[model samples]
Target: MLQSLVPLLVDGLANAALIFFVAVGLTLVFSVLRILNVAHGSFYSIGAYAAASIGLWIVSSGFSPYLTFPALLLSAALVAALFGPLVERTLVRWTYGKSEAVQILVTFGLFLILEDLQRMVFGVQSLYEDTPMALLGITEIGGIVYLNYQLLLIGLAAVVIIGLRLLIRHTRHGKFLAAVVADREVSQTLGIDTNRVFIMAFALGVFLAALGGALATPTSGVAPGLGAETVVLAFAVAAIGGLGQIEGAAIAAVIVGLARVLAIYYAPALDAVAPYLVMLVVLLIRPYGLFGSVTTRRI
Candidate 1:
């Protein structure tokens, strides 16, 4: 029983790690910008594509294989830097005070444009870059062999959570973000440049999403329509965790991940809908989400 459970637990955590990264990023951006970005998942696919392309190039050029690990991070940073500020300044900023429907429509248009751009550049073929996974070797856990890279993912996710908590509690930028989140008008009145904050927060969100994609490239294929699929799952996660709640996102990711793993093991047909099922159940129980609370507006 222990042996049987170990593999399930490990797989669940591994799944949760990837989901958490993207979910947290989505929630973070929503918390700060109050905008639900439909195009966020495009950044994830772009990162995966970038990492795979760069890793492939490194191998072809006879560079040190160890460089592939760093390439993953570099890919995410580059995507965030390239698109984050540009999108925020041009498209996102315009929708600040607009209705949510307008925001969704505009971002959906952006998503469509990005999807086409990805197809044009990467073609329809799937890309795989797994040097990092290959280099890491394998380990035996509960009589089952597992990739060391999977364990590394679990560790990295934990690190990101802790780092975010520390940043929010101890850093100046984090304080600024908190203040803005608490009261945008007051923050602006206190001389905080909310525009700059918006850009930084959006970029950070892109980085997290891209990082999730880059990391997953070692274990999964990067293909056309991947962004759409991911965003749907991400939205389910965001809803289950409660939008704009980081801790909620983490817990929700874990719950969704476990649900998925269980479905894969016990009911293959339900694997695809596992996360959404979890979301539905959670929303039924607590409409505000696990960590979300309804806020009353001051008249």
Candidate 2:
């Protein structure tokens, strides 16, 4: 029993770790900006492409293979820095005070644009870079061999959860974000620069999404349509957890991850739909999500 379960648990947690980054970032942006960014997954793909490209370049250029580890983080940061403020200020800000339809339409259009951009820039071929994974090697647990990089991802996810909690509960910027989430108008009235907050929040969201992609690049292939697939999973996660709940997102990611793994193990044909199935059941029961509730919105 332990032998059979160990692989399942390890794979599930590893899957959840990547999903958590994207889901939490999506939830965070929605919590702050009150907008669901359909284009958020584009950043993820871009980051993967960047990381793989950078890692490949480093190896080809006679650089140490270990540099690939830092390259993952650097790729995420670069993607966020380049596109975060740009998208938030121009496209996202325009959708503010607008209808949900308008927001969705605008973001979807942005998603299309980014998708095309990715195809044009990165081409349609799948890219793979696994230097970091190779460097870390593997570990044996429960009589099973598992990639150490996978375990590292699980640890990283836990650290992110704790780090985010601390950031929100103990940091000054977190206070501002909390205030804004509580009452945007009141936050502005209290002299908080809501615009700045929005920019930072969006950028952070991009960073998280990109980081997920970058980390996953070592274990998976980066292809043109990866963003579309990831965004759907992200939306399922966000919905299952409640759109704006951070803790909800974390829990939802685990559920979705486990669902996917289980499906792969037991019913390979249902692998793709497992997460959505869980989302459907959860939504049918809770409607507002596990961690979400009915609250009055202030215009």
What's the TM-score of every candidate structure? 0.98, 0.98
- Best candidate per lDDT, number? 2
Worst 10 residues of 1 by lDDT: 290-299
lDDT of 2 by residue, 1-299 (tens): 88888898999999999999999999999999999899989888999999999999999999999999999999999999999999999989999989899999999999999999998998999999999999999988656899999999999999999998899899999999999988899999999999999999999999999999999999996998999999989999999999999999999999999999999999999999999999999999999999999998655
Lowest-sum lDDT 10-residue window in model 2: 138-147
RMSD to the hidden true structure, all candidates: 1.0, 0.9
lDDT string for model 1 (95-169, tens) is 997888999999999999999999999999999989999999999755699889989999999999999888888
Residue 215 error, candidate 2, Å: 0.4
**lDDT at position 269, candidate 1:** 100
